[model samples]
Target chain A: MTVNVSVTVNGMRHEISGVEPRLLLSDFLRDTLGLTGTHVGCEHGVCGACTVLMDGHSVRSCLTLAVQANGSEITTVEGLGTPETLNVLQTQFREHHGLQCGFCTPGMLMTGEDLLRKYPLATDEEIREGLSGNLCRCTGYQNIVAAIRSAAALRRENA
Target chain B: MKPARFEYVAPASVDAAVETLLAANGEGKLLAGGQSLLPLLNFRMARPAVLVDLNGIKELSFIELRGESVVIGALTRHREIEHSPLIASRLPVMSAAMRHVAHLAIRNRGTIGGSLSHADPAAELPMMAMFYAARLTVQGPAGRRTIAAKDFFVDALTNCLEPEEIVVEIEFPIPQHDGWVFEEVARRFGDFALASIAVSIRRGQSGIEDARVAAMGVADTPLRLEDVERRLCEIEIDVRMPDRFCEWVRSSVSPNSDLHASGEYRKHLLGELARRALKTALAAKGDRR
Candidate 1:
């Protein structure tokens, strides 16, 4: 049976009906909403490629049913930046060459945004630990760590 | 992967939730944070006819300090416990073990009650609950009842709750032990532990007053090493104690062989991890003195 789900995605309120209870938030965002910036990797919770912010906290979009996010505010990769202007974390990812294949970039960016907002990110070790859930097969994670570290530094400097 | 078709119901109250489950009649599955359940659903490992979403029951999400116990609603998320200053000061061992639970995102959504109900032998919360001797309050058609952590676990990925019963809250008595430690070894930082050990020690004028040792990922369920604890209380707290405990731990558990590690490797880990945890806990006791 289909369920009615209303959610605010990237500050835009979406009231959708006939959403399958089995539909994943990842699929709902990508297919239904046409926000393909949020990529789906391992459908299981392990791969962080489908990570998104639900009410400002990172959650596995693939693991979350679309109906579960009914009344919540969600922020996908599309919410972060545009082709004309990039957010601080997105710019850092580009400058540091954090993406080799770009498959894991969206998840990495979302998770990075969550970490930067909440954690101290005082050390590279702390950054690595925070990024443990998200996996990157390329770049050996050195560049991703560099990107997040730089973004965290910028956040500290601005504060 | 996608879950098989299932009807969904989000009940606003615990009584309503119970009634929904009763109506499903053993075919309904309670959906908590969905950290673990969703994965199982996507894999089609669990195909319940109905999914009872419990997130709407706001009353089941709380963390309160009551007298000498910490009463945590079953829906309390792991991230909440990890950052709770009260948990940090009162149940430091549990706070320390929280980091070993999945990653930050999973922790944000994974509920303590869900973790205990899912009951993966390698997961950290089950071991912590068993270590603390926590009491779980559950509600069913017959009404609310309490179950000790020891009796709650029936086997791996299994709990003693009847199909219609739902966990309401868990009560952890703040331990009086002066020192405690939780050590785990996983292939990756957020992977399921290969084997882990937890130790809490109390010192007396004589030597050791009491001790509790528990091990996970080395048995069918999280184990309380009573024999090891008894031996620890009998022995003098000294250089040789860890070694003695290590040997005893090595012989105590019967771990399964999986793709992750051999039973022998898990046993080895239990021994070494136990030794390290015991030594660290003893040093913490010395610092307290």
Candidate 2:
């Protein structure tokens, strides 16, 4: 009925005990760990609102079981940066108006991080395809693409 | 949504997994990527008494080029295959299909073994398995046995796999295809295709040595159009071959008109998409030569 999971989330090592085998990683982060940045939109894997990095690979936390993530590393949206200091992607998004209602911003930011790390994001087409998994009903995605593009360029420039 | 409470076991080895699965006596469900299975559980479509977690069985997670085929462990992730240079140089068609499986996030976690076992009628992997004439190796309490891809799929979200058996590896022959292409018609990118077709031709000195044509989302499972392949092999390669191939394809399929597209429309598109897919495959084959 209950399972134990020892996971390193956002560089903090925590041993969570008595976790239900059915607990979703999304709920575990938001409810159990008190890290509510990870949103759950469609419960099904469609909307990428609950995206998180498990061992550096982006996965749908809503689709991932909390017990399944035992002995793994997870990075949620809260791991990226704090309100006082925004990360490079957050800054770019703010400057480019990536979020309007902000319901999909957390997912958008985490997906952006993974894309920036893995892909070149050379063209708008590439950026659009990379972000296809995550949807934002607001802002029309034109600015999201722009923000990721700018962030990609800035990353390249700095490198 | 949360999955209903179920017993869980993390087996560290194949023998252990098989033993645990055997103990469940067909009441157990193996969790590989959990991409497809987890969704089903959350929706309450499937409620297995035991969840045989196979992630800890790291042995079933490698890609190796064997003598004449690429031997892939059942736990190998789609993302690994998508980015694999060996798959690129050896099993190129698989690389092409990987981009369409799901978003990068899902692909990063979804496994080919799980996909094949799940056997979604519209899924790309099952279609690929049929296209490649893949051979699956399954391990059970009795012993290990191999099943052809064509015989593995039974119907929508169903397979010939016994509950006690787990798919261990898949063997895809290195195609010496003269031309090959995987084409699908999805409303949006990454969505389950309404209808998809994959074509490959193996030509000899005099004429066609071999031809393989397969389609997905038009029937209970991925259909390998044998009639289309034989006719294509018999005819002279030309612009008209596409039209001729379409006739064969349209006649062969048994499509169900779902909310997405009418069965009539699917049958109609079968001709056109199959034609284009065959043409593109032929062109690709010619380019390589």
Candidate 3:
């Protein structure tokens, strides 16, 4: 069966109809809406590669049914900032080598972005704890923690 | 991993949800924070003919303290409970335990009611609820009814909840104990526990006034080992007794062996955890309690 769900994706609202109950939010965002920046890995909810902001909270898009997101606001990696105007977290990720393969980068950025916003001056341990859910096979989490710390410091100085 | 095709209903009210569920009989599944349900759907492990999405029912998503018990709305996400100051203070075991569930991403979308209804034997929330004697409130075509934690969990991946019934909230009684411990052993962080234990002890001038030990991943459901607790009664609240109790606990539970670990290994670890957790709970008292 089909359902009508009006989801505000990346600040742009869309009144979607006939969406399958089985359609994952990650699939809808990437395949349907063409928001391909949000990657999908470990659809069983282990990997945070599919992480996105659902009403400002980091949720695994793959594990979330698109219908479950009815009337909710979502922010994808594409919403963070473009190459022309990079967000502080994005800058920090690249500058501090927070990513290597870049597959887990979007999830890392979104998780780190949400974390730093909540804790602009978070300690090294807090940053690590905050991003523990997002896994990066290449970076070993050392550089990711460093990048998040650096982003936090940058946000703090600007504040 | 597409789910089986089914009818979808996004109900705005609890009564409407109940009606929708009744119309489908036992063929419907209530969708809360879809962390667990969606995965089951993706894997095709659970394919309901109709999914009653409860996200539209905003009233069933809250964490409030009612007298001694913290009434957690069924739709309340695990992330909310993890950060809630009320749950942190009143039922710190739940807050502390929730962190060990899958991770931040799963917790952000996983609901307390969902986890409880899923009834994964290794889940932290179910064991914590069993230890605290949390009351599960359900709304169905028959009206509302409350079930004690013991009665709620019928078996692994099963509960007493009826077809048309929806779990609305879980009420955890304020633990009277001045001491508590939540411990688990997993192969990696965020993985399901091979075996876990949550213990609460209340000490008085008369010695040990109250003690409760609920173990997970050892049986079909989270079990409150009353026999072990009974053996611990009248014994002095000290280092030696807990060790002895652990030895007794080793013989009590018959845990199943799976890919994570062997049943014998789980029994061995259960003894060690019981001893270690009891000691830690005793030491962690006075300041937090």
Top candidate on TM-score is 1
Clash pairs, candidate 2, are: B178-B285, B179-B285, B257-B263
Tell me the tens digit of each residue's lDDT in model 1 across A1-159: 898999999999999999999999999999999999998988989989999999999999999999999999999999998988999999999999999999999999999999998799999989998999999998899999999999999999999
Regions of candidate 3 where Cα sits further than 4 Å from its true position? A117-129, A153-159, B286-289
Model 1 residue A101 distance off true place after TM-score fit, in angstroms: 1.1
lDDT of 3: 0.84
Which digits, one per residue and each the tens of the lDDT, describe model 1 over residues B1-289? Answer: 2999999999999899999999998899999999999988999999999999999999999999999999999999999998898998888888889988989899999999999999999999999899999999999999999999999999999999998999999999998888888888999887889998888888898777888888899887899888988988887777998999999999888888999999999999889988888888877752210
Q: In candidate 1 chain B, where is summed lDDT lowest over 10 consecutive residues?
A: B280-289
Q: Given candidate 2, what's the lDDT at residue A61?
A: 95
Give the CA lDDT, 0 to 100, for residue B76 in model 1.
93
**What lDDT does candidate 2 reach at residue A153?**
98
Candidate 2 regions with alpha-carbon error over 4 angstroms: B203-207, B286-289
For each candidate, give its TM-score against the true structure: 0.97, 0.95, 0.92
Interface root-mean-square deviation of model 2 in angstroms is: 1.2
Better of 2 and 3 by DockQ: 2
